[model samples]
Target: MLGQPAQLLEREPYISFLSSSALVIKQWLLFDPMPESDARFLLVDLRQRLPVVSMNDGASFHIADGEPAVASDPAYDGSQPTLIPGQLVPTPVWDDRAGSCNWDAKAVLEVTLADCPPVSDERVRAAMELYVTSQYDFLPRSLYLAMLTVLDGLATGSKRADRIAKWIDEKVSEAEEFNDQSLLDGLRGLKNGSHAAGIRALVKRAVLYLGGSEQEAARQANTVKRLYRVRSQLSHQSDTVELDLARATQLTRLVLNAVVSNPALLNDDAGEEASLAGGRERRTQWIAEAEVAIRRAKPDCAAVEKAIRRPLIMGKNGLLIAHLADRTQWAIDDGGARPVSDEMASEWAALDESFGERL
Candidate 1:
C-alpha cells in the first residue's frame, strides 16, 4: 500500500524533482523516497548487497553505489545547481538495468440533445396546390404553340379544298414508299406531308358535299385557304403564329355545325322534314353530338387547360386545334376538375339516341 502524500509525490515528477533538488542543496545528501512499502524493502535489500564508496569535492561530499568514481578532482564545484523555472531538461540515456517506465493521461466528454419531428399537414397541402398550378398553367401554355400548328393544317381545306384532297391521297401513297428498315425515318419525313394530305382530303370532302351553291363553297374555300396560308407561313417562313382563341372557337363551331347539318355529306336519306328544316336542326344536332363525343373522350386536361387559359396560342406554323384539346385536358386534370358527370353522360346518351343509332 502507498500513502496519499507519497503517491502524489511519485505521480507528479516536476514536484518530486523540485523537492529532491532543494533537499540536496540544504543537507548536502541524497534521499530516495519510496511511496510503497514493497519498493522501500527492495531498495534496502539492494543497498545491503551492493558496495558503497564516498567521493569528496572541495565544497561537498556524496556517496554512489556500484560504479567507480570516474572523476574525483577537487576542482569540481558541488554547490547547489541554479534551477530555472519552466526550463526543459535533456532526457537521460536508456539503461536496461533501470527496467521499463511509462506515463499516460486520458480524458473524455459527452453531450446529448432532443430530436426534431416531421412537417405539418398544411405545408403538404400547400405543396400539392403549387404542383397543380404549375402543371395546369405553366406547362400547358408552353405546349400550346405546337398545338396551333397542327390545327392550322387540319383547317387548311376550306381554301384549296380540291388540291388539299389530292395532296392527302398523294401523301398516303408516299407513306407506302418506305422499306421495313427505313419506315420510322420515312414516316418522320412525312409528318408535314401527312398532315397536309389529311387536310386536303377533309377539304375535298367538305367541298364536294357542300358545293351545291358556288357562293357557299367559295366562302368555305376561303376559310380553308386562309388556314393553309397560316400553315405555310409556320412551316416554311418561320413566321410566328398567334391563335386568337375567340376566333378559333367561332370557326370550330361553324365548321362542326356545317358538317353536322349536311346529312347528305354522310349519305343520309333526304327526308321531307330534313329538307323543310333547311339543315338548321341538323347543324345544331351535330354540334351537340360533337360536344358529347368530346366529353366522352375526356382528353388530357393539361392540353385543354392550356388552350382555355391562353388568349392566343402562338406557334411556328399556326393554331393547332388538336393541341388545344390536349392542353385543355391537361389544365382540367391539373386543376382537379373532373369531366362531364354521370348525369351529363346520361343526357348525351339520350341525345345520341334521338339523333339515330348510327351517330
Candidate 2:
C-alpha cells in the first residue's frame, strides 16, 4: 500500500498559521506562542527551500520542534506494547529522514505475560549459536528446532500435549500410506515439531510450563498453530507473504524459555502411543498417577520465580536451582539432566509430603 506522505504535513497541523493582507514577514511573527528566536530559525530554513504548495489563504507558519503536542483526544497508543519511550515506527524500513519520504523507527520485539518470568539465558545462548546471520529463512526453523529439543526431551513427562503424542502415534502406526516412514524417523530423532499437531503439543506444553492452566494453554496453542500456518506459507506457498516476524520471534523466545527451564517434562514417556485395547487403560492410569503426584508435590517454584535473570546453579544429584528475585529457591528437574527410574515418579510424587520436611 502506497502511503500518502505528501499530505502528512497537512494532516499533522502542529504549526500555527497567522493570516494577513500582505505577504510580509510581520504576518508570520504573530503566530500563537511563536517565540521570535524560534521563528527566525524556521524562517531561515523556509527561505532556502520554499514549499511547493501555496499559502495563498494563510500568511506563514513555524514548526515547533521543542515540545510535543499532545491532544486531549489523542489516538490510542497501539494494539501492541512497547517498552521504549515515544517509539516511532517507520511505515517502511528504508524510509528517509524527510517527512515526505520516511518516519521514525520503532522497537523490534514486544512480549507480555501476566507474570513475566525471567528469560532463559541458556536457551538464548543456544539459539544464538544456531541462528544464521542475515538470512531469515533458516532462523525460524532453527528456533523451532531448539524448542523442539526441549519438547522432545519433555515429551515423556507431559499430560498436556496428548494430541501431539497421539498424532505422532498415528503417523507411526500408518506410515506406509503417506510415505511417512521419514516422518516416523523424524519423530524417532526427537524432532516432533515437523507437523502442526506436534507444534500444537509443544505450544500447549510451553504454556503449561509458564504457570498457565490447561484451558489457557489450549487457547495459546491456537496462536502457535496460526504461527506455524504462516511459517508453512514461507515454504509451501507461491504468492507474496508478509509475516509479523517480531511477534514470531518473541513467541518463539517465550516457548523456548519455557522448555529450557522446565526440562523435567522431557524424561517421561507418558504420551507414547498405545494399542486401543489395553493402551487406553494404561494411558488413563498414567495420567491419573501424574495428577496424583502433582497434587502431592504442589511445586511452588513459579510463585517464587520473579528473577530478572537467574543464573542456573547445579546442585546435588544433577538438580538445578536458581535463586529467585524474592530470595526464594526455585528448583529444576534432577531427572531431566539424566536418566531416572520410572519409580522416581513415585518418589517425585512423595516429594511434597516427605522430602522437603526432612530437609
Candidate 3:
C-alpha cells in the first residue's frame, strides 16, 4: 500500500500520501512478535474506467473494453469511435445515491487532501484516525465511544493529570497527619475528581486553548457533559441508546483541526515540564502565543463570504433557476429543479422537521 503511486509529500515527523483514486484495502497482517517489523497490506485501487449510462427507470449499463458500441445511434452525428482498453479513466461524480456507477462519497476528502497539513503529533494522528472511522461506522455505540475516546486523549493535558496526582498525594498526607482512616476510604476507587468534573474541565480547557471564545468553550463543555451522560447510559443500561453523532463529530473535528493546523498546541507537555521545573510563567506565556497563532491561521469569515458571493446563478423566488455566464460549466451540466411554490415550501418544511427528528 505504501509503495503505490501517490503524491508523497513529506513534512518534518510525518508524511501524507494523497491518491487520486480510491484505494480499498484487501488484506492486512500484523507482526505481533516483532514490534519493529513493518506492517504489510494489499491495496486494490487500479481498475479499468468504463463509461456507464443510467436510465430514468433505474437501469444502468457500463461499456467495457469487450463491449460492442452502438453504431446506429440517433444522438451521434458521425461514426462512433471504437472504445479500446484504457481509453477512459474514472472521475468523481456528484451523485449521492448508493450503488451508483460513479458513487464517490469521499470526493470532498480527495479534493482537500493536497491542501491538508501533515500532522506533526502522533496522538493527533491517532485521534484523526478515530474521527475518520466514526464518520463511516454505522454502529451508534461504536461511534459515540470513538469520538469520546478522541476527546479523552486530546482534551486532557499532562498538567491536569499532574494536578490530579498531587491532589491524591495531598489526601494521603492528610490521612497520615490527622490519623483519619475515613479519609483513606474516600480515596479508594476515586479517580480524577469524579469523572464528570474531570471531563468537563478537560473539554473547557481544550476549547479555550484552541482559540475558541469563552462562551463557545463553555457551551461545548456543556455539550460534552451531556454526551458523557449518554455514554454512561449506553454502558450501564443497554447496548443501544439515542445519541447525537453530529455534535460529537463536530467537537472531534474542532480539536483535531486546531492541533493539526497548529502543532505547537500539542506541545502542552513542554509547558507542564517547565512548570514542574519552577518556570510556571513560561507555560502561561506559551499558551497565549499558541492561541494567537491559531487565531491567525483561521480564515477570515467576512473575506470568505465576499469571495463566495459570486453572480453565478439566476434566482427566482429564492430558488436558483439557471446559471449565469460567470458560473462554471460543471455547475451548469447537472440537471435539477428549482421548485418555487406553496406546496413545495410545505413539503420542504416537512422534510426539515423529519431531519431534525433524526438528529
Candidate 4:
C-alpha cells in the first residue's frame, strides 16, 4: 500500500497535465468548424496502471491516463457521456456525452500550442478561464449572465457615442454648408458627448475586427442586445427568461475564441477601453474622483441631510420619494420613510384622509 501511494503521487503531475490538455481539446471540439460532434467521452482512471487500447487491427497503443475512451462496441451511439476520471466532479453538472474513438488525425494536428493564445495575456487567460467554468450545468441562466458580464468587460465603448459621432461626421461631410451651424446647435443638446462605443457596438466591432464576417458580427451583437434585456430584467425586476443552453453557450464560446485568438481586440488608442488587469481599480478611481468633485461643490453634511429629507417627488397615492441618508431613494408615506413596498404605501395613503394636503 505504501508503494502504491508513492507511485500514484509520482504520476499525479502527468495525470494533471493530461486533464489540463483535455480542457483545451474540449474547447477545440466545441468551437472548431470541422468537428462533426462536440460530444465528450469518459476518461476512466486506471489508478497506477497505464491505460492501453487494443485496436481491432490487432495493434495496441498506450493512451494518456486522462484521455477519454468508450467501451468497444459496434452499436455505440455516443450517448452516456462521462466526466474526466480520477476527479471528484459532480456528474449532474456536466452535459457532455461519450463519443467514438474514430479520431480525425488532421483536426488534431490543426490545433497546437502555437494556435492557442498566450496565457501571458491576462484578458485572454481570464476569458479562457471563464469559458472553461461556464461548462458547468449549475444554473444555466446565471452562467449565461456571467458569460455576458465577461463579454461586457471585453467589449468596451459607448454605443450612444458611436452613433452620435457617425451621425455628426456623416452630416458634416455630406452637408451643403448651410446645415453646419444647425448641426452644431443640435449637438449642444446631445446627452452623451464621449466618443466611446457602447457595450453592444463594442461587442460587434470586436467580433468583426477579430475575423468574423459583417453578418455574423451583427448577429452576435443583436444576440447580446437581446440577452442584455434579459440581464436587465433579472437584475432589476428579478425576472428570468427561458434560455437555450446550447445556443447560449455556443455564442459565448465563439466570442471567447475570437477574443482569445486576438487579445488586441481589447485595446483602443483612445484609452476608452478598460485595462483588463486594473479595470476595477480604474472604475473605482473614476467613482472616487466624481465623489471628490461633488464634495468640493456641495454644502455641509447638515445641509445635505436637509436636502435629502426634502421630497423630490410625490405620487398621487401620497407616496413621497426622497433620498435616504445613504443616498438611496425610498417611498415615504404615513409610516415615515422606511423601505416598504408600493402596496404598503397605498395602504398608508388610504388610511389618511388629509394625505393630499401633506403631499
Candidate 5:
C-alpha cells in the first residue's frame, strides 16, 4: 500500500471512525519510521476524549511495507499494534471475521486563515492574546475576563467623564454673578454625571471613540452594563447568569477588534500588559496554539482558524491545534445578536457550580 499511488477514498469517514470526539494524539508520530521528520496535524472531534493508553484501537490503520520479509517498517521500532489488517480469521459467525466498522460520519478540517494585520498597539495585541488563550478551555468566565481585560486596557485613561464639570463650573459661576438660582439648580446634575465611571459610561466612551452614533453607543453601553453586572455576580457573589456564550464571545471579539483599530484610547504610560500577564500566569499551566493564534473564532464554531505556513511540530507536551475556515472572522459581518436572557441562560452554556471555584 505504501508503494501504490495514494488511495483516492473519502478521508472523513475513515478519519472520523478512527477519531471520535474525545481523543487527540498530539505530537504523536503517526506510525512513522522516520523519527527525525517533523510534521504534525489537528484532527478535530476525531473521537471522544480518551486516556493516553499504549494504544487506541480505533486510531490504528495499516499500510503494507514493501519488504514483506518482516511485518511493519523494520528500520524503526515500536510496540506491536493489535488487530493488523487482513489477518483476522475468528468471529462469532464464520461468514464474517473482518471485525466491524461503520463509515458514515463525515468531518474534515478546511483551513482558511486570513493574513493577520500588523498589530501596532501593545494593549490591543495583549487583549487579543488573552482572548485567544481563553478559547481552549471553552469557558465563559474566560470570555468575560477577556472582555474585561481589553476594556480595562483600552478604556480612555483620560477621565471617563467628559470634562463637563469645567463647562458646568463656568455656567454656575456666570449664573451666580447674575444671582440666577434657576440655572444653578439645573446644573447640579453635573456633579454626579461627571463622576460616572461605571460600565455604561465607560462603554459609551469606547463606542463614541470608535465613531459609533449616540444610539449605537447607548445600545452597546447598555449591553456593557448588563454584562458587567453578570460579571460582577460571578466574580463577587459566585452567582450564575444564563448567558449565550457564542453570542457573548462574538460581541467580546468585536469590542476587542475595535480597540485594536483605535489604540489611542489607552495612551496611558502603564499599558494593560502587567495585569494581563499576571492573570495568564495564574491560570491553567498550558496554552494551545489554537487558543492564542490570530484567526476568526465564529459563533457556534469552536475551532481556531489560522494559516498553515510550515509543518508545525510539537513535543510530547504541546498545545492542542485546530483549523481555520472562511476568510473573515466569524460574525464580524453578521450584525449584532440578541443579548443574554433568562431562557438563554439555561438553554445555552451557563456557569455551573464549579465556576465559582475558578474565581
Candidate 6:
C-alpha cells in the first residue's frame, strides 16, 4: 500500500497497479500531513518502477528499487532529475528560450573576431586632438613666412639687393670652413688661397662696380655655400643641430629678400609656362604632388589644434577653450579686411560657445 498517489505518477502499468492495490488494502492513507515514515515507505514501493516523483507539497523523492528511497532538498523538486552521488554528470544550462540569454554567444564571437575594445570618451577625444595637432604642426611655417616676405619685397621693388649680397658673402666665408678640399684647392689656385676666397674676390669686384666694398662682395660670395648647408641640414636632419628658431627666422628674411630682389636668378619664365601647361592637362596630378610636399613641412597650427582636442577629462575642456581663443587670433590675422577689436571679440565669443567653454 506504500506508494505515491496515482495522480502524482506518470501513466505507467506498474504505478497503476500499485495505486489500485494500495487503495483496496487501505494501507495508502489520505493524510493531510503525511508523516515522514509514510512518505519514505510510499517512496520505496514507487521506486520499483519510476525512479523519481514530485510531491504535492513541492518536495521530491528518489527511489532505488530493492534499496533505500531518498527525499530531495526542499529547494529542488523531482521535476528535474540530477546525477546521483559518485556519478559524473554534465550540468547543462538550457537556453532554448526565445530571447538573448545572459551570455550572448554570437556577440562574444563577434567581439573575438573584431578585437575591438570599448572606446572611452576620453580616449576618443585624445585621438581627435592628436590628429588636429599633427595637421597644424606639419605646415611649413618658416617656408610660408619667407614666401610672404619675398612677395612683399617684390610688391615694393625694394633696393635691398646690395644688403642681401653682403649677407651672402658673409655666409659664404663661414661655409668655406666646411668645403671639400678639392674645391678649396681650386679656389686657392685662382689666387693661391681657396675657391671661396676666389669667389669672394669676384664678388668684391661685382660689389666694387656697384659702389660697395670688395669685403662686402666677398661676404656675399661666401653666403651661397653657408645658406645651402643650412638648408640641407634643415631638410635632412631630425635634430636641430646648429640651426635654431632665430637662425631660421633670419635666414627666412634673407632668402625672401634676395629672391624677391633678384627674381631672374631663381625663376625661368619659359620653365614656369611649361610646368603650368603640363598641370593644365593633368588637372589634379600636380596638386596632389604639392599636397604631399605641404604635409611634409609639418605646420604648427595643426599640432596646436590637436593638443587642444586631447581627451583627459580634467584638461580636455581647457584645451578646447584654448583653441577657441586661438581661432579668434586666426580670424584676426586671416580676415580679408583688417578685423576690428569688436569683431575679433565676437568671433572669440562664437568659438567659445561652439566649444562649450570660455578661452
- Return the top candidate by TM-score: 3
Against the correct fold, how does model 3 do in TM-score?
0.41
Instruction: Give the TM-score comparing model 6 with the true structure, all chains together.
Output: 0.17
Residue pairs clashing, model 3: none
Instruction: Report residue 354 deviation for candidate 5 (angstroms).
Output: 32
State residue 261's C-alpha deviation in candidate 3, in Å. 2.5
- Residues 1-359 of candidate 5 have per-residue lDDT tens digits of 12111111221122233224322221111222321211111111111111101011123322222221223322312222212122332121112213233422121111101111234455565566555544544456776666666555555423323577677777788778877787788775554532214335555544444333355546666666666667667777755676546544545554554344344434332323322332243222212333343333334544444312110111112222233353222111123222224453343223211111111
Q: Which stretches of candidate 5 lie over 4 Å from their true place?
A: 1-116, 157-202, 205-212, 267-359
Candidate 1 per-residue lDDT over residues 1-359, each given as its tens digit: 11111110111113224233321221111123333444444333323211110000011112243422222232212232212122333221221222121311010000000011111233222322222222223333233333333334233322234566567557656766564536645534443444444443343344333212233334434554565556456567765675433333333323322333343332223322333254343334333433444455564223231121111111111111212343222112222334445564454334211111122
For model 1, the stretches where C-alpha displacement exceeds 4 angstroms are 1-194, 200-212, 235-247, 258-359
Whole-model lDDT per candidate: 0.30, 0.36, 0.40, 0.40, 0.37, 0.31
Please give, for residues 120-157, the per-residue lDDT of candidate 2 as tens digits: 34433344223322122334555454433433332332
- What would the TM-scores of all predictions be? 0.22, 0.29, 0.41, 0.36, 0.34, 0.17
lDDT of each residue in 1-359, candidate 6, tens digit only = 22222212121112224233221111111212345666545443344212111111111223322443232322222233222222323222331233322333233223321222222233222322222222223246454334223222222211224556566556556659887776655433332333333323332232222222234334544543454455557668777545333333332233322222222322333323333343243223323332333334433332222112111111112222122224422221111212226665565455322112233
Q: Relative to the unseen true structure, what is the C-alpha lDDT of residue 101 in candidate 3, on a scale of 0 to 100?
A: 29
Name model 4 segments beyond 4 Å from true: 1-111, 159-197, 268-359
Model 2: worst 10 consecutive residues (lDDT sum) = 307-316
Off by over 4 Å in 3: 1-111, 157-171, 174-198, 209-211, 263-359
User: Tens-digit lDDT track for model 3 on 22-58?
Assistant: 2222111111221111211111111111100011111
Q: For residue 190, give model 2's deviation from the true position in Å.
A: 14
Q: How much lDDT does candidate 5 score?
A: 0.37
- The predicted structure with the larger TM-score, 1 or 2, is 2
Q: Assess candidate 2 and give its TM-score to the true structure.
A: 0.29
